[model samples]
Target: MHLADILALRPVPAAALLMAITRRCPLTCAHCSTSSLLSSEEHPAEWFSGFVETIEPEDRPELIMLTGGEPMLRPRLVSSIASAARSLGTRTMVLTGGFFAPRVPPALDDVAHVSVSLDVFHQREVPRENVFRLVHVLAERGVAVSFHVVGSGPDDPYLTEVIETIRREFRDGVPILVGRVRAAGRARAWATADERVSSDRPRPCTMAAWPTVSADGTIAACCNQDVLDHRPIPGHLRLGHVSSDSWRSIRTRCRTSPLLRAIRTGGPQWASGRSDGGYCGTCRLLGTEQEAPASPAIAYLEQQVIHAQLSAGPAGFMRRYGEARFADLVMLGR
Candidate 1:
């Protein structure tokens, strides 16, 4: 699958699954989101394999995105999940730090897409040329490739230089998804807070649409790092555990939860009817706030919002969720 194809489905509820297969990474980039270390916590392989095995061909997500502190560390698990997901008609994608570059992993054979991380922090551990080489090989093998690049911000000189180089080296064959580093994970200690003005407007939250499987196998309604790492996940955002919940069950909850539906259609500020917290802060506070009851109005609004987002396409989705300055880059290899 192409990068645009995967991102185009990003707004649809339960259309995709983001699974953090492991939290152990060899490269300790300074801005590492998961704060992964060689001894970082990673669950037993069965926790992941067992959950994937439960996916029935008739009721499965269109895509399964495998990620981690470094998902490539578990080559066998990556191959196993890709094979199983593909057999069920579900495309699989992997996001890696490219530590094993210069030698592509045999497991990626079953993967339809691979997105490698490229940035200043990552370059400290994994060479940019090695990542480029890995993408080159993957592209030659007919596997779709893209770059998940991060920089200080849209105007950061590093982003400009690297983007230009990537466009030149790949001749725009490899799409790039550029984003600003957030104050999360290991970067929390030093990364500056986002300065975007918080608004009480009814802004829809697309992040709440997909179910994210955290490192410990706890499934969350959103991909927020705090939700993934914190204990006692807010009642509203916590989905059933992978150890017990099947894909169908999780999808049902994600799609049917009244609060989640409202969040998707009108955002947390609108759903909770309070704007004390920021966008995500308001979402995290939903557990304490009342849950929006299922209603025809909410259902209708959800569909309308989904339709509008679908009309916006991949670059549009990036414009809202990613850095707008470079949103068109997602269309480079389309």
Candidate 2:
């Protein structure tokens, strides 16, 4: 979505502009969310630069997220992205596999924060020693560090190792945000078994600030727009082009409409909440640990999901949704 058209959707001061610089990824994690992999197209650096220029001084945001299968793979990318972000008086953050962290230009370190993906897949593609090196470099440069655990994949034999590693990191105060794999394209077809989940919990609360603009630039009331409405962010959507519309009020009503339903479970004994414990039944069962020795049930589910995907061609689903309209991280509103 065009940046101007996106801002017209709602006044979101804290926006997470998810710029998928490149979809090419070296690691094929078992549970890959967003499924942005090799062969993905990158928006032109000029396009992004123009976007940064379009942000009025008054429209500065708290954070702008640069993500993708691996954003660092863009050969031409250096401080160009960081410079565009810094020019707007906003803090820039990046999500990377850390394989190319060492190659990051020295100037990009200032005013940029990084969230490293450190799952078993990351370990395989990027040496642990290398990840530590990247982390140290970024830390020395004063960039904030956070790690995301990609656990929703078929139970890797290394489940114990992954959990153990993340636990230690969490204990040390390095923030650990558990990422729910969203079912898009191939992930969505077998979502039941694969459980491409997210942190967004259906709430009775109002989404006053959250809004998302799709790649085509149409605006939606929240981040779940693609999942629910299947509408392009800046273009085709349930609420077409909110150019002159008061997006604040429109989004408010849309968020609370009784006839409308989001990805929510009803009543008790149903799945709900942001964390695992908050949900009941199937949702809780997704990752619940038993007192007895771990069985292969969960593992089987993961395999079954993959097997079904393989048989049906998982690539089809992966190709369905290219990228998120916005990258607020949490809540469609930033």
Candidate 3:
């Protein structure tokens, strides 16, 4: 699958799954999201394999995205999961830091797509030339590839230079997903916080649609770095542990949860009606608050909202959650 195809499915509930296969990475970029290192914690391959085995063909996610400090660190496990997911009609994608650039691992042979993280910070560790070489190899091998670039903001000169470079180098054959660096993970200490949602309007969270599996085996409702890293995940956001929970169980909770539905359709501020804090802060508080039962009217309205977003398509999603200037790049080489 291509980047456009993946982003188009972003607003659909339970359409995809994200697995953080390992926390160990060779690179030590200053703005690392997971605060990963060569000695970071990592779970056994069996835990991940067992979870994939439970994905029944009839009720499985459309895609399974493998990520990590660097998922390529465990090539065999990546291949195994991709093979398993493909058997059930589910495609797989892997996002890596490209530490092993210029050398495509056999593990990624079965993956539908591969996303490489490239930015000023990442370049400090993995040379830009090496990443370009790797991307060329993957594309030559027929593996759909893209770059996940982050910058200080829309006007960052680094973003401008790198984007132009990628376009020139690939001749627009490769696409990119551009985003602003958020105040999360290692960047939390220095990066500026993202803009907060207005209390006056609903700002739905598109990221909540995909269930994320953390390194510790806990499955969270969303991919918030804090939610994944912190202990005692809020009850409302905690789906279940992969060690015990089945795919059916997780999907049911993701699709049926009233809080999640409210957040997805109306955003955390809209759902909670308290704008004293940030967007995710309000979301974290949702578990403690008492939520009324969803009425038929509310359900109908939410469905309408979902349909509208679905019709708006991937570019719309990128306009909201990604760097708007580069949103159309997602459809490049489609």
- Please name the candidate that would achieve the greatest TM-score relative to the true structure: 1
lDDT of 2: 0.44
- What's each prediction's clash count? 0, 16, 0
* RMSD of each predicted structure: 1.0, 15.1, 1.1
Error of 2 at 274 (Å): 22
Instruction: For each candidate, give its TM-score against the true structure.
Output: 0.98, 0.55, 0.97
lDDT of 3 by residue, 65-108 (tens): 99998898999999999999999999999999998887888887
Candidates 1 and 2, the one with greater lDDT: 1
Rank list by TM-score? 1, 3, 2
Which residue pairs clash in candidate 1? none
Segments of candidate 1 deviating more than 4 angstroms: none
How many backbone collisions does model 3 have? Answer: 0
* Candidate 3's TM-score: 0.97
lDDT of 2 by residue, 26-54 (tens): 66655455565575444555554445455
For residue 53, what is the lDDT in candidate 2?
52
